[model samples]
Each structure stands twice: as structure tokens, then as C-alpha cells.
Target: MNKLNIDSLNFYFSKSTDVNDICVKLKSFQKKSHQLYKAHKHREAKQIALAYLELTDSLITKNNDDNCLLENRILFLNRLCELEKNHENYDKAYHYLIQIEKTINDKPVKDKINFQHQLQNSLNKAVIKNHLNMPQKAIEIAKETFKENISSIYYDKNSIESLSLEADITKTLADSYILLGKELNNASYLDSAFYFYHKSYDAAKIYDSSAKSAAFKHNIAMTDVLMARKDYKGAINSINNYKNTANSFDYKHHEYMNKAICYHALKNSDSAMYFAKKLIHNKKDKCRRSNLITLYNILSKEYFNLNEIDSAYKYSKLEITSFEKARKNKEKTFQLLYNNDFAEAKKLNSQIIKQENVNDKNKLIYIFSIIIILLLTYLYLVSKKKETNQIILDLKNNNVVEKTEKVAYNINEDFEAEILTAINLMEQQDAYLQADFSINKIAEKLETNSTYISFVFNKHKQETFKQYFTKKKISYIIDKLNTDTTYRKYSIQALAEEIGYGSSSAFTRAFKKQMNVTPSAYIKSLSK
Candidate 1:
């Protein structure tokens, strides 16, 4: 990575969603992981973790939360887990998991979830390795790193950040424990793994992250994958969902691996060689390196499939080189991230300590006074300004106006109609009637800036928004006066209400304010 590209400054300090840049930062973090693990470097690691989390939070939160940023999402998650693991921060993990699970529940990004799951699985395997006696499987699992995070773009609410939080990773963690239990030959370890997995799963299940698909479909897909793993031909029937999903490559790897194993069982050298070669080439990361190498031991298998002994021998020689290269790359990336993370952590701690000791009361007072002056100036100009669509947008700061979940309007429709339509929609929501239903509130609903809404309203409406919006309410009152006798049933106070009014006195005040007459007088005019 270029030195300029990789930043050790910390996550929140850098506000970018560039995955490559994030990856570079993560690589730097990985470089420091080891040094930070040492006794002296512990504070350093803690600081790096703090800085990493701050960035994670800042990145996750945006003016408009767009979770389509798959890599950033994954990196945030990955770093969170790594930080928690080093610190034994189950509470922090729980918090992070809450955010992740909420995203998972809210969005339907299958590809992104798969990447998340892969990282999680790697973590599960790592934790279980020390406790379990399955050295072989643990070593085999270690090879399954470097899975790139993928994003799944579904419908509007399908983005993770847009969703409400629900925690489900606990179940995934539990499942990993169950698998670990089976791998453990010792019954005691099995029980321990079972208890842990059960606890995790129970907590996770409390979370409800429903896919748009039905619960039955989830069961069916899960069952099919499990069943397919049992019978090769059965997999041919059951594995289509598994084979075609975002995790298809994983299924394909297993399929080819199974075919190779079956061919070997049947002593069919010709068939085994074809599947074996395909496995190494296409499903490179899926199969075990030892099993991959053993294929070369079968001199007869290679010749039969390729129709040339020499070709078989060439592939056999290539496997070791490929494995070694992959291993070296992992080592290099891991080391780089570890070193950077350690250094940044130490720097971060020093900075935080320095900041804690410092005070700036005089400077703060000066800043506050400036802010107050600026605010008063802003309010005065706004109230005094001529009201137009532009003025309205400006008054409300564009974003504070009422909004619909309106897809962004096109360039062609820049008129009063659009603003009217938006206002009407908000009115329909009874937003205008609410006490909190100010221009700012509306702009927030529309996800635009308050100033921009005021601009549009002022430019097109030709009247100040306050006056215009009041006119609309006055018009509504007139409509009620003409159409609804329900207004007459009340006293001047009651009559004010048949339409929308907070209080009888407010109605009288507004009626006189708008019509220059009381509600009682307006009724007498109608009688005449």
C-alpha cells in the first residue's frame, strides 16, 4: 500500500468510505496487533481500539445512513471484534453486535451478511481452537481467512444502517460452538461448548432479524445445505439454493471436493483428475492444503484424466507454490496491520491524556458569545426577509420542511407544483397541525436541509412561507365554515374547533388575525 493512502491517524478522524483506504488502514492496524498485545503495548492497543471504534461509529453514522458501503461496514465489524477479543470486552461486543444485528434485521443484503458471517466464523474458530483438542481441524480452519466482505443491495429499507437494531450474531456464535463440540473428542469439552453455544444461541434468538423470505424458507435452505453435505447425489438435488446464493463458491468448492473424493474411492483416475484439477483452480481456498497435496500422490489419477502423465505432474508441482504464495501474503498483511495499530494506539493514549489535563475556559466563552451573536443575526434577517419559495427554503434552511419518502425528484420538475405537492403530502400526514411541525421538523422528515426547503418555498410560492402556510390553514378554516355545520354547533369557541384548533381562544385569535373578525362575526355574515 502507498504511504499516503494508508492512514494511521484513526477512524473517526478520517471520514471516508473508500474500502481500499479502509483496508489500507486495517492493514496498518494488523501490523500493530502483535506489538499491541505485549504487556507494555497493552495501553497502545486499547487506544487504537478506542480510536478504531470512534471511527467505526462516525462512519456508521451519516447525515444519510447509506449501508451500501460493504467494505466499510465489514471493516468496522472486523475491527470491533478484534478489539473486543483483545480486551475481553463482552459488553462492547454486545453493543457492537446490537448495531450489527440491527443492521442485519433492517437490511436484506445477503452478500454483505455472508461476508459478515465469514468473519464471525473465523472468530468462532479462533476462540474454540485453544479450548478444543482438534489441532488438525483448527489448523484447517485457519486457512479460511482473507474472505473479502461483499455487500447486498436490496430495496430502500434494505440498507443495514437504515434498520432498527436486533441482535442475532449470538446464535451464529452458538452454532460455531456446537460444531466445535462435535469436533472435540472429549465429552467434557463437548458439554462446555454446548453450554456456551446454547447460551449464545438463546441470547441471539431474542433478536428478530427476519429476512423478507418466510421462516420456512430459512429452514428449508439451512436444512438443504446440511443434507446436501451428507449425500453427494443428494447434494445434487438439495444444494441448488446453497450453490446459487452469495455463498455459491463455497458450495461449488465442496461439490468438486466431494467429486474428487468419490472418484478416488472408486479408483477412477480419469474422473478424479478432472474434478481435482478444477478444485485447485476454481475453488482454490475451499479445500484443505493437505488434501490438495495428496492429489499429487496419485500419479495414475492425473494421467488418466488429462490423457498425459506430464500434465498431471505439472499440476501436482503447482499446488505447493500456490499454497506458499497465499500463506506469505496473509503473513505480510497481518504483520503490517499489527505494527501500525500498536504505534497509533500509543500515540492516541498520549494525546488523550494531554487533552484531559488541558483547559480553555476563556476560549470557550469567546466561542459561545460569537455563536450567540451569529444566531441573533440569522433570526433577524430571516424574519425581516421577503417571503418567496426561495425565502421559505432559506427560512427553514431547506431541510426543515415537511417531506415525503419521495424518491428524489428529477431535474425537470423545479416548480411550485413540487413544493405544493410536498406540502400537501405533509399536510395529509396532519403534520401541519402538530406543535413540533415546524419547517425544521418538516425538512428533517424530507431529509433535505432546512435552508433548501425554504428556498424552494420562497422562490415558487411568491409569498413568505409563514404567510403562505397560514393562508393554507385559513383556507382550510373557510372550507370548514362553508361546508360543515358542525362548526355552528359549538359556541364561537366550539365553532372554531370543528375545524383543527388547539384551543377556542387560539381559534378566535387566529380568526381575527386572518379575517379581521371573530368566529361569531363570521357566522353572522354567513347568516345574512
Candidate 2:
């Protein structure tokens, strides 16, 4: 069948409709379609858009003599691509994008219109690849053009088209870099992501409110990259500086969520809970269900830490309900927004299930070990307390201060004093109790470097940083067991949570390495 002649198509739309008339009609249709889309009338909006496209399509001549006609057709094609992408019709979006590319390539010389069209094609194609969970492909597509045109993009910031394209491409590169970095566990990729996010912000038009809002969002995303790297202090500092910008951009909910996460990372549970609860009570309607689920999960954990069992249970149930609701109400229109992330999460979940299935025998053995430990714990607690007191008394009588070991070499007086003071401050402040605590964090707080902290532990403490820190924290747990009968009754998991370990297995391994005794053995011996 022959394709219909575009010149003869008419439904109150003339065969001689000029480019300006077609554009005006297209814009009006777009405005109405957007309203319908927001109202969740996607079918009606799609039908209207298809009907409107027929008129817009007829304006372009086959010869491509009219520049205005070609430009208008390119604009319509880009709009259709966006609409299809939003609908999660990736194949259709790709088809429209291909047509757009063909139209742009049909023009031999690189005029202003041709240049912008080429950039639009590159940006759309890269974004589509990203949504398909092909970060490497997205990176390749973006870099192919971005590397060549970067100088031109930077210098053409005076024009809206150039500035918008630059901002869009840089942001896409930033997102691709961060996603790939997280998947590969490569710090260099995260650094590049941050650099590009900053570039995106710089390329944004200062006076355009919409552009500035996007820049603020890019900055917020950079903080998330910092948190992923376990740079909690850096994340907190970033939130403090730009949190207000979120309000100006009508993104106060995002500000609240970021602040909650940062405070939780810092172990300031009270502040975390304050911000989280504020969002739930005041701004719940304004936030996405997925985000609310995250807030609920955070609240549950924080309340559990505080031993507020009722609040913990409440939020835990809320977390489950929120998750189910989010899944059920998943908006297809925004699928492209988180398609790569969702796919990645699904892949991780599948791998975890497969691993669990393969390790069934080890899991059984672990369960039996836990049962034995529980049985021994019960028997020890039932034994006579007089024997326990006698054993403790004997140990007290035999206790003496052990001689300290000398460092590997004589250190400078100033360096020695500085290191000692920093160690003392760490102990006094109980910084080890933070969930995100690390040698790097301590170094930052002490105004030194990780290399120096690692050196101090090795030379003065006769251990690596992990060994030294583990011994210090485990020693405190031992002291608690000796002094408080209630502490001894706590399960290994509960004890681990109390002491800021991410998991009971991690705590157990550290305790055994430091004291040469399993936690269960230590608990039983104390009771005996």
C-alpha cells in the first residue's frame, strides 16, 4: 500500500498549512495533552496527540526545501519520542529518535538547526540506553559527541539551545558514571560523576528558574554519591549548604529525606527521627510512595535502636505496607526515570537468592551452631551466682596493668602528641559508635589523614587500624558484660546493634579475633 500523500491530508487542517500555523496548533495540542496526562487520562492524551500529529506531519515537503518546515517536523518528532519514552514504549521512542536523526542528517551542512537537532538525537539515544540498563553504551554514546563538542558547548552558553543541551548531556554523563561506579565499586568513576554534576550546574542558565532547579537536583544527587562512598560528613555538609535551595525549587520533601539519611548515617537518631516524622505528618502527600517507604524503614531501625518497641513495630508495619503500595501504584509514565535502578536492584535480588540456595548446607550448620549456643547460654544463666562471683573476684585480685609496647621507632615529639590527643578525643567522644565510623572518618575529624591514623595504630598500638578499632570496641562490650547482667542476657544480634556493627556475623568475627574467644563462650564463662 502506498503511504498517504502528506500534502493532501486534511481535517479542517489545510493542505497549505504554513510552518507557523502547524507549530501553533501543535503547541496547543501539547498543552492539552499534558493536562490530560497529569490527570491520568493517558489513553485520551495519546489519542489526541496521534490525531494532532497527522496535521503537523503534512507541513513538511518531501523535497526538504523549506528549512522552517524541516525544523518543525524535527520538533514534533522529538516530542513524540518523549511521549513514547514516558509511556515506557522504548521501541517506539527509538523509532521516532531514528527518524529524527535521519531528518537531521539529510541536511548536508551543520547549520544552527542541524547542530541542535544532532545534539538532541545524541542526548535522547544516550538516555534511552541508560534506561535499558546499558550504562556502558550510554557512556559511549554521550562521550562520542560530548568529547568533540565540549569546547563549543562551553563557549556557547549565551544561547538557550546550547546551554540546555550542555546541561542535559553533562547530567546524563554524571548519572551514567555514578551508576557504573556503584556497580563496579570503582571510586574513580564516582569522582568523575561528581565532576560532571558540577559541570552540569555550571552550564545551567542562572536566570532560568527551571534550569536552576535541575542544577539543585544534580547537587543533591552528588551528595548521594558521597554517602555511597561512606563520606557521611561530606554528605551532611552538602545538605546543610544547599538544603534551602530545595525549598526554593519546591523540593522540600527531598531536602527532608536527604537530611534524615545523613543524620541517620551520623548516628544522630533523634534528629533523623525528627525530620522523618515531620515528612510523614506534614508532607506525606507531597512525596512519592517509594520515598515514603525509605523513610519508614529508617524510622523503624532508629526506633529499634532506642528500644521504643511500639514505635519500631509501627514503622516496621508501615514500611511493609508502603512497599506494597508503591509496587502496586508504580507509574508507567515515569518508568524511564528509574528503569536502570529498578533493573539493577532486581538483578541483585536474584543473585542473593541464588547464593542463598547454593549455601543451604552452610546455612543449616550455622543454624545448629546458634541452637547450641542458646542451649549453653540457658544452662550457664541457671547455674549458681556464688561461683561466678568467686571467679570474678579472683580475676580482680590477679589483675595488673600490663606494660605498654614500644613503637617501631622514635617518633617526633609534636607528631606523637598530636596522635595521642586525637586518639584520646576519639575515645572520649565515643566516635566508634557511629554506624559509618571508619579510620577515614576519624582522620577527617582529627584534621589529619588516613595514612597517619593507620600508621599510628600500626606503630603505637601494634595492630592495623581495623584490629585496633575492633579491640577497643570489643573491650567495651566485655566491660558491659562484666558490670551489667542485663547486657549479658542480650542476644548476639542485639549486642551487635547496640555497639554499631552492621551485622552480628561481623561483630562475632571481630570479637573472636580480638579476644581469642567466641562471644557465646565469653557470655557463658561470665555466668559460670
Candidate number with greatest TM-score: 2
Please give the lDDT score at residue 329 for candidate 1: 42
Residues 246-268, candidate 1, lDDT per residue (tens digit)? Answer: 32123455555556655565566
- Candidates in order, TM-scores: namely 0.27, 0.47
- The CA lDDT of each predicted structure is 0.49, 0.70
lDDT (Cα, tens digit) per residue for candidate 2, span 412-507: 678867877777787786667656778887678767778777776677777787776777789888988999897776667657756669678899
Worst 10 residues of 2 by lDDT: 1-10
lDDT of candidate model 1 versus the reference? 0.49
As for model 2, its CA RMSD to the true structure in angstroms is 18.5
The CA lDDT at 508 in model 2 is: 97
Q: Clashes in each model (backbone N, CA, C under 3 Å)?
A: 54, 0
